[model samples]
Target: MADRLTGQPFTTRSEIIAQHGMAATSQPLATQVAIDILKQGGNAIDAAIAANALLGLVEPTGSGIGGDLFAIIWDAQSQQLFGLNGSGRSPISLPLNYFSQQKLTAIPAFGPLSVSTPGTVDAWYEMHQKFGSLSMATLFQPTIDYAEQGFPMTETISIEMALSAKHLQGFPNFAQTYMPNGMTPTKGTLFKNPHLANTLKHIAKYGRNGFYKGDIAKTISRYMKDNGGFLNEEDLSQHKSEWVTPISTHYRGFDVWELPPNGQGIAVLQILNMLEQHDISRMGFGSEALIHTVIETIKLVYEDRAKFYCDPDFNHIPIKTLLSKDYAQKRNALIHYKANLQVGSGMSGSHHIGQNLSALNHGDTVYLTTADKQGNMVSLIQSNYRGMGSGMTPTNLGFVLQNRGQLFSLHPQDHNVYQPNKRPFNTIIPAFVTQNDKPWLSFGVMGGPVQPQMQVQILMNLIDFKMNLQEAGDAPRFLHAGTSQPTGKKMTQGGYISLESGFSASVMQGLIDRGHDIQDLSGEFGGYQAIAWNDKKQVYFGASESRKDGQASGY
Candidate 1:
């Protein structure tokens, strides 16, 4: 019954997994947890929060309650998407002169100074208060159980644990908790964190006060005091998440949406607009021409991003001008074939306008997308900035705080310069797309600068190449790195575009012949998870990237 050459029968067929309601996440258990919540009468928002909590437990390297959260919720009842910026601000006590006094050229990556007040907890409470149908207690119990009772660790997490163990060895109890045996465990190992369980249990029962005002707050403040961190009880108590409107740009008859600045979601829209001028479908995937165009287009977009994107509260952001078709056209005029050009920011017409940006932008992160039977959908992403975060574990609280401060620039006039109680430009953004005022796709790819690039590729794969969700995610991707740093870092010589393994040798040479710098690499492409609704069929299709250990299913 099997075709020996292609192994047809035995091989898994990558199809759009269809169901009445669907869930897709970077962890199989998280996806199952979400579906369970939906089946129990919870809406997409409820399932999303539940799934995110579980993901923190199952994939601690990529995320945890100690990090930040950004979400885009598709509320079927209201028929509108909601954006929440759950990112925290830098310490108020740390003024602009702090870095100067410390003789620091760049912000430190680890310890107290790097930690922003944890925002995921506040985000969870905000979203739940607005949309959750299930009790918070009910939603958190499963993850608390998993954290309390040891669960089998996945291979990828094990590898990450071993890699990050050295940086974490110095943090209090990090070694004792994560590496009980004084060394990171291998795959198939059982790991547990009763400390995290207690933390979640307290939050579930007492809500925001449990984490922000009580023992949790005390623990964080004490750790900062003892370790030269500026965070205090005041900072914890003052923490709040903002609800904002989502922005959009039209592409090929569909409206792609993303959260505005302090997020690079604007850059994603800019990239789509720049590439829209080219006939991508005709050029095709893996073509040197397509790759060259995208790389150049992204370079131009990021150039504007570095100089303008920042926290709007701290800077004047010309959101409208940056996303204007005129701006995209102006940037698109810079692309030159056969020569890798170093690009920077462009003015929005005759006037200089502010752009959107985020910090702690690069990180190991997790994305979850959910859709319920009622047509409600959610695209949510959370991150700790870097793998294992800032390596600063508070006394016995059992989670790493994000190194978001690293994104703050020391340049006095920079839009993203260090500021008291100001949120950094955030990189972990969730995205959704709608067509004709109806929900289309809810998806996100997790990585630092790679997120926006991967997202564009996914859309192009689906729209231009006509690939199914699974195929789009599985297809080989091109990653351009060291391109443009919005934080004011000087542009390096020339950034290289890395190609995944599946590209033919001729394609590789073809890119080089076009004066593009190419590299053979593995593992920088983002982990993608998405759910698309087909209104005509009245079914939902889910997809999970083959690059990650994840699952996508519907019911």
Candidate 2:
């Protein structure tokens, strides 16, 4: 019997596996844009920008110009690593007293009050200014064309839009802009956003100011002010993305690097550190032992993240102490060979040390990985907190604003307290692994609070289990959702671990035996994309998540 969905003949694995220059992503058009840029002799940065711009057009609900950006770039020539902190700060008008006066317990859900100044466009410009050969205008042309002329609605985009449509219906501008005719466009239907096209055009012509200080900013601020929102002209004018040095640790013979603070990259490094002592290969891939070790390591790292990780500017993140070999050894010592340890019981060393760590808020983000012909590589991640970002589409800008402000803790005593002009805690971490001094792979995953867990699994698959980039990304995964205490009493239900379909039944039973409440997921836990540099082949190979409706293509 024929498969009713895909009418055409399905290609065999032998044929599909023979394809070259792989590029994996969450959307088809974004992958094509990267392939086009690579074909045109552009490097990784250029290709990444091209792809990222197109993602804003096609996958508007996930990411766009109105968001923060972060990246870990590996320069092959100088053998130096660079980090871009494209996160935006809170509005100066957002005083702590404002929330107090309004008697608000937490930040608003989706509105102007929840919005933050977007830093993605300027971040792209800054990255191009420092490393790209192609003009910024050229990088944006593909995206502008897609936005103005229209592009086909993809299965992933359509589904995500429809599922989240309820949150989007309240904002008339967003509805009119994205759903125009009072209906979500079906897959393969042509979708265009003229307002976004004009916005991109202004950026191409006038540079980054096209959105920050000019007409676009004015329109956004005006809309927010009139709508009982906190974002103002001052927020737009004050927004600036920074460049920071990346934090790294050596595992086996490879060096893994990730951005500091704001991002949860340090947590990923910590997980690797905890698992470093175990010969996971000896446990055999996907064995109960291997899964247990991996899950235990994730719990240790995430426990620290919940306790201590936040914006470094606002809180003292002991990055060096956390990633140090001594800390890893101490945490690794808690792993028992026979069974899974309870969450609170897993804490080693002084209990006072654990008190310093506090749980922070998470945000929605996108991740992109690229490797150019010249060996330059980029692991990029960006976000607007959630789908359609606060659900506020200011009159002519054509982009939804990010709700980063919601990441702030409403409590004044909290380390991540909502403060004027302070950045929020973000989960958008990108990672790179290097052999010797050369970049070996660029990878990242998109999930609100699942990033650290997903990253650790990918690293384990590649570093510990010896799998390739595609296999590592395609492998089944699990996440131990961290817990939050409202009144110093730990909430155990939040500690429930989620497992994907491919995990072994033995592993599931083992987790259950250890007192973990287990939940099953239908393989859509997280979306991951990765690129590996093959020194022998002298070409880049990319892999996109099979669970997602996107592909990876390279030229």
Candidate 3:
């Protein structure tokens, strides 16, 4: 039995009936939305769509209708995983020549130019048309109600909004919508977004067309034209989310799955492949040796991402070659047992030798996971690129546009150079692990570029060190910013790693001795949500990060 806060058996592990289907997310309202959908006899897709819609309302900064979405859906009946790529492409009118003519180095911060095709609504409709068993009206009611009626402000939402308040100052619509009185809403305050409510009502009535081709589109395009943005009606009308196959790799006795190029899923697979070379279980959980190995692997994968990963439509990602076991083995062999080398120093024969990785700080992304009684599962992640995204809110739209275009390189000759209709490099990566063709876990971490690193470490903690879902997510983490040539050949700033509250002082000291710059973090790093199926007991156990105000609930 699990003990309660007061030492009473508030709920027994045995008394808890394992409803084969469950839902968990970074916001309680979103979780409730999924649960409500399930109770209304909706399938996994319906519940997931419902939850996702509500998340945009409850956690506006983390995600919104204006952002991109990615998902890996497991069809329990078909025994296959399907990938949904809802990321938007650049505007057709945004030509390469335009940048040259304007002498623009990079995409602007906000207004209309920063907006992509806005495929999120279209993607949600696509998923529903193919897999959902509920009416679009039913799926959207929860979100509409939350927006119209009101919801209590959560501390996590409050703190993040407050931190990014400066960015919000520039956009009048954003200020009026989120910080109505020009003040951050305190926790427990009842916040309502009538504009968003009207928007949701429009979506529910006209399907995705409501947003893509009707009044909403006209309103948005008009706002962009009036405010120096580049988006137009054609960009919105031509957008369509693609359904692609997910990439997978076997680890130990399980098959790990993630989405393809344009996402950092391959990086997650690469990190796992590298760690598979050693008997990480023997290192013990939270041990310095294990932590060191994980950190080093993260550095390698992130280096690859910074140098190579981009939209598959634009660049050949070489995912198959990179994730192959043979390649991982070759890369893993370079790690020296006793010393930590500077980032990019361990690459054996890679050509891009001298390039330095940037120390860019990112904010705002949302993650959610779901499973149905029929065994259907989905691990979904979405983001607006930055908080209040680009800080450009269209008048009366009740949402901020994403600044994803900032991810593109400014150099005209670079492969990731800014171009019209090109999707920028993205950091949102959602993952799943299965044993014998059955999903054992569906999980994700919400952060900017740090997502892949966090996912890899959590997987290691669970599969390698045999920790529970909570423990794995609760473990201390380290991030390698890679080498920067700001000063000289001195490996930029090597360590600057983040250690969670639970790590021992000795472990921290060991990392310091290993030439790592360490920093102590207090619950400000990231949020993880997971659903692990206990095969033996035939029950599903869900855990949400305690660092955030989230909940894991099951029916």
Candidate 4:
């Protein structure tokens, strides 16, 4: 039996990681590396970057050099929250005319055509340049070592790799990199990628130039040409991570912040605002009424998401109109608890906007949270879009290019229609919560649309149900997915609700009686990681998901 550390009856899966610093990530080694960085006097930014880089190497099924990134960092000194939109843009060379010419109604989810210019390396360097204490080379050393010498394959990674093989085996270099022995490695097998190590080493030595330019860029260019993909060196060289202000909505006095679109963080705010309209606490956790309210809110907000959320650089999104309390008040009236759920975007004199239930991709991202002694906290999420990405592996890169372009709509009138150099609609988001202008929590969940769904439930658990960070994370969750699927499928009426175990039979029956489409989902809720600060005590608490091979630790 383990000796309990805290005297206050150390309860729940969350640990009191306080005093100095703490780090929680989807990989145990990455978590340790982050804590080690904190101990070495690196700040939260450096610790987060260190862990995230390792995730790219170890959890390549989820994230990698070929994917995109998003982060919300709480600057303890400035008392200001910052957001980074690290998502990549579509190929400048790929025009809307091409899709129209091909008569394709949807962006292909796999193959070279789906590839976007990867932005993760730029994100790592940008944050580090702004806030890191450790040198770039030093921050990436742990991942480099793991990649070259190999780290033991986790059961989750092995499962994902095997699942991906059938879909990705024929893609170039994928077999050479991930299936070197003509098969996915079994759990605990020592998996090494010297090629990935070399790629990482190049960037560490040369900084951003190493990735966005030079040999790395050329290799990606060649791969694109050979595969008929349109992303070119210009797209790679022109890429820059944007520093944006975080958007927030007050929920029960706590301010929940998310990055502005093209990522779906705003959806997190919208759902929260709708829930705040009613006394969620009065309904209680897992109650049919609460579940129904949550589901109906999601259905409405996601209808708005599909209609208007897009790359702001290309489309003028009415952020002020979308986040307004008046808008939420109007939307909240549509939630008839007793009626069958048939939802759509409410008319806003607002952006005149108009909205699937396809398979929601899961388990393709690594979410991490880190805090430093200085009070800086980071909530970061990185992903390859879907497990193993587009199956378009550049030779010797040891990572698959992201298929983010798949989120684009083929409809010309759609705000999210694919265009040259535009970012597609993004799902990966990192979140922060502040109370009384002080950093309260930094957290995120992994899984496509499930990211926002999990965010709402996690915040509600903490705020409404008074659950600790660990308990909030460990609690069974429900996913109401009626949003347009990335596969271009139509959103279903009364979108199916996937409930995890623990709800009472009566609650399930109650939902059914209310005309809810109920189903059981085994493990697709999300993998959560979060860090909460006890401002009075000057300490932090960290929690890692029970569903993932992850850890939360501090010194």
Candidate 5:
């Protein structure tokens, strides 16, 4: 297959092309903000930070300062990629004994117990210190202005706000900040948060200290203490983003890189490794054979994910062994024409694979990609777990604390079991593709487990099927939900598969005939945004998800 000259039925629009720079984000305003930063003499890193700050203000339903951040950057100067793990840890003061003492089987989805130390602000500062061209104040000014002056809520965000308001209104400051006048903002409503502006101003002037060591930290600690939470000033102050070496797997001569454990990114690499065994292109896109192989591969990889993916500091992960081609081949051999509902971890031994599980769906998140004239590109993702997060808004903070800690398993023997000061198993990850040691693409799909599944599909679409950047993102995707997660959930029913509306009835029937359970679940497929570098053309290509209020623009 080759790149199509005519439009494919799935493509929403042609790829945005430009020589100087390009950006793709979930929100149009954020994309414009990135472009503006690039035009203002800022590098890709600076532009990404600026756009993320603005997103925190305008798209708080998904991302905010209260969430965690992860990024993969293609540094033009070094000609190498960098990975940043900006995820936060559970409070050291919160002991596992407390949960056991309370007789709680699982952490509550919302409220104080789920909140963790926020790491987004520190991650921004760290990325800036290493690669930023503009001052922190300059990068933050646009968001601060928008926060105080107000910005129009997008259609999707407004509906999400109303939903969040219903669940989080009881939390301190949530109603005041998001539900002004006792109601959530509707589409086109000009929402303003002067308090968030003040907070951003503090960060602009004092850097990470503004949030981790100063008034913001103190306020968060006080609120948690009074509200039956365990996070404190110490947890905030001790937080630091780690600069990690990105790991990769070669697929069809392309090096696909993702961060190590504590995030589910490697699941993409695992799926791809297993997929490399089959000539999927021959099976054809959306064919029953292709879908079945991918789905079965996912189930096998997720079993390993549930058992091994965790905070590296707490347990040693066999990163090398797990990503081995031999292991992938062994796993791939298990796939057949039919679905396999009864799967177990490939490696022996047992931790409590979760007895009860909640399908992580519609995880509110933001993913954006940017490339500048200097040839630098950034793939960044940020999120407040679930919807608007833990619903434990600190008084006057104007943001919700992330419920990421809810991902930690209560099972004592699990590697991802709840532990004080340990980072939870993260769902958000940034991805990159390099061809022959040069940056080729910076992209990400935003949702929980939907991420790795989409990542593999995107890669296959581009490499195996030869789709253009936009077409790859816009193509019909299959979401494999209910797989065992790091939360120790077991897959007793083999889980189910959800396909986008674009799939043909023949494909659906084929999958069902193969013993695969197919469901019509829309809006849970995850949002995608990507930027691909065309070295020969000396230009960039960008694509944004049509399912979202997204934009892919260049200049």
Candidate 6:
């Protein structure tokens, strides 16, 4: 009954191929919205921004204007990749001493205390200012109309919405905005937020000032003051997205790229650098050797991540040393046929590393990639952090403030420790790949720590196993969670493994024999989206994860 010729068993469909333009995103509506923008003569970056705005309205569980954004853009004209870090900082008024006086060991996951200045709007403005050809009004109008006219909630978003309502409903203005009539929305339910429509109108008209300096900024500041939150108008106004050079590591023949510190993107490069030593193709996909090697490699790099990964502006990160081939070789030497019970970071740290690994694995985020006929491609990831954010919904603003500050450590000496005007350690990242100095792939996986792990697997599937774009994403993914986190928690007892459903029983037994703690976990593998350039065919191949309510379409 199914066409099995071009697809793996797990692949729900073949990759979408198009010569003109392509877009892949977590929601079908959002994907279509991007295609619409491209059809309207917008570039890949413009379509990405428009689709992201629509996602904030349609899939608030994973993304919103309240979140932070990171992107890797492949500019066909320059033949160079660009990275944008649009993350925000903590309020200058709240110093580390405040947390000390409060005697809080970690920032709370939800509430005004965890709130940070939102950077999504500024990110949109920055991106549009640099590369956009269309007016802000043109890019945002579709989402504004959708927000007012309403869109049907997909099943995935519906489930997440119900879960979010349980924790967020009690917060100020959350119920009035999300849970209308005091009820959680179900699948196929049409939802509208006229307030969000108004907000989008302001953004479309006034660009960045509409959000960070005007009535919107005042409302946010007033809301924080009343709710005991630290974020204020000044914090919002001072927020800016920085354009940074993307860092890369050569794996097998292709160059894999990710953003530097402040975000955990480079961890993908670090992990790939370690795995480069192994001849994984011979081991085969889903084999004991390959899975074990990948899992172990992930553990090795994540150790370095916890100790070294942070905002480079605040602390000097040993990027050159960590990504050095010599360093990877030394780390790879520590891996063997059996799981290493005692794993430590490559670097020495004052705080204990890998001592008490946190079991928290899930994160709420959305990833999308778009390719234009001009050969430009954009890989973008956005998140509200911990799902639906801090629950600090400003009145009539129609979006919650991000709780990203929760990732900051209370340890004063830690690189990611809470500080005035410093950004919290961000988990969201965007990734890209190039071959022979040409844009090869624009892709990303969205989950907490799962982002880097899944990203590494995707590259391996493509380069090592030669799987097609769709098959590469649909392949069974293993999540090796509980590595030391930026929040100052360490992994203990070698951490554990959560295998996806597609792995064989023998492979499961193989991991168990190797001293791995194989356990069943609710699927947290991650949602993926990608667009690859076919230099020969002169077309684009797009793929979206089957596990998500997403679509990959082309014109």
Candidate whose lDDT is highest = 5
lDDT of each: 0.82, 0.74, 0.76, 0.85, 0.90, 0.88
Task: Kindly report which residue pairs in candidate 6 clash with one another.
Answer: 356-490, 357-490, 357-491
Model 6's lDDT to the true fold? 0.88
Candidate 3's TM-score: 0.91
Candidate 1 residue lDDT tens string, 168-270: 7787767876887788778888878888889888888889999989898999888888888888888889999999999999999999999998988999999
Worst 10 residues of 3 by lDDT: 8-17
Give residue 75's error in model 6 in angstroms: 1.3
lDDT of 3 by residue, 54-137 (tens): 888888768889899999888888988899999888777777677557786555655555667676798899889988899989
Residue-level lDDT for 122 in candidate 1: 93
Question: 81-194, model 2: which lDDT tens digit per residue?
Answer: 899999988888778888779897677757777787888988998899889988877888998888888988988678777765678678748888888688778899999988
Q: What's the TM-score of each model vs. the native?
A: 0.95, 0.90, 0.91, 0.95, 0.98, 0.98
Which regions of candidate 2 deviate over 4 angstroms?
1-23, 337-364, 485-494
Ranking by lDDT: 5, 6, 4, 1, 3, 2
Q: Candidates 3 and 4: which is better by TM-score?
A: 4
Q: lDDT (0-100) at residue 191 of candidate 6?
A: 92
* Candidate 3 regions with alpha-carbon error over 4 angstroms: 1-17, 96-113, 338-359, 482-495, 520-524
Q: What is the lDDT of residue 508 in candidate 2?
A: 83
Clashing pairs in 5: 354-488
